[model samples]
Target: MTYRPTVRGRRLARELRRLRELQRLTLQEVADRLDWSRATVSRLETGQTRPKPNDIADLLDLYGVPSPQRDALITLAREAGQRGWWTAYADVFTGSYVALEDEASLIRTWDTQLIHGLLQTEDYARAVITAGRMLPTTEDIERRIDARKARQALLNRERAPQIHLIFDECVLKRPIGGPGVMRAQLEWLLELAERPQITIQVLPFEAREHAGLDGRFTILSFPDPADPDIAYVEGTMGDVYLESAEAIASHGERFERIMKQAMSPEDSAPLIAEAARSSP
Candidate 1:
């Protein structure tokens, strides 16, 4: 089984790599100094292997990380090795997005083709999975559906992330699972929009020159200021997670621009309700 690391794991890996670079130490140098294999050092630095707290402490001592910061990093290393709920659906998710999404305090998403996963109904999701040909067999599709439903539970969890979705107007009109399914999906969006923690917006077709023309993306922010925000872009090739300050800033500005072109939540909700009624 392939082991997928959690967001904390990735953060720990980045910090370790940064520390090595700061001290101008090569991977081989560190491995030789610590009497460990170069492969072991590489795996830990790349997040391919779970980090041990004791090993992390030893590294910290070598790097001269002091006081509370060192303690915090050790805590993070331990947390990084722990499994998250998404680990159960590893076959379905196959990426770090779910883990990061699970831990994010805020999720800002823009969907051009369909509704966001958090707002998709079961029937709607099934239709989408079928259309995308994401899974080879019915059983696999069903498991993925189950995984998606489980992901939606995050919206109801205590101190759930504040989810903001901006959908292209065409998404509301696309009938993915026949008329009934499409209607249900649109109605579901309306219901979710009523929640205080959720915000829904629609970018109408009239807005020909929109900022999201580049593609769909999600920006996740954590409650802890120490944890930097992430910008994620998904495509036919694969998924990309952008962590650089410049990348995050660019995505943030793009989202803000799209939001400006999108309808207000109040207006979007009514349009969603109308689309549901008119789906047939």
Candidate 2:
């Protein structure tokens, strides 16, 4: 099975690499010692494959990792290998993003196009996916919609992530499914804004040539500080997950600037309400 690692999975991979380097053992040397293929060791360190607890224990023993640390890492390996709900929609969630999103403690997104996916209503999602993807079959579209609904459930779960969304004002005016669907979506946004964990802001058209003009990006912050923040950018060609400290800092600053320019959640609520009332 292809591995789409969650935050814990990534942390385990980093620990594995660090331990091997600390022992001054090359991948080939470790593979030869364990009578395993070099590719297997490399894949384990790079998180290309799900780690088995037994394999992790073997590596820990070889590295002279003590009982407590070894036991901790082995536990992590087990957790990493356990499939998440996203596995059910493996075709739809072809990346680690959904897995990461499921565990994020804070989700900050800056978008110049449509509303954030978690905030989208069913009708709006259908229109957007149908138009944006040009999916050939109805089954394909519904599968994605189902996957999206499944993903949205994270917001309602106990200890839900604090979501801060800043989208371009044009999104409110875009009649995606139709006037009625768009209106309902806007009203839905107003209702969602009432929730304590969600904050919705709109960057008006007048804020031209702003920091967020570069395009949309999402920053996922995990509860565990060891995991580090990830800046994600989705594009037609592919998706990019930025983890370097410099990249995270850059995106963080840009998002702050965009937030500064955007209407406050209080002001944005009125704007969204007005948009819903107007003829689309």
Q: Candidate 2: where are CA atoms >4 Å away? A: none
lDDT of 2 by residue, 1-280 (tens): 5799989899999999999999999999999999999999999998889999999999999999997888999999999999999999999989999999999999999988898999899999999899999999999999999999999998789899999999999888778898999999999989889999999999998888799988999999998989999999999999999999999999999999999999999999999999999845
Q: List the residue pairs that clash in candidate 2.
A: none
- Number of the predicted model whose lDDT against the real structure is largest: 2
Give me the candidate number with maximum TM-score.
Answer: 2
lDDT of 1 by residue, 96-134 (tens): 899889999999999899888888999999999888866
Question: Pairs clashing in candidate 1?
Answer: none
> What TM-score does model 1 achieve against the real structure?
0.94
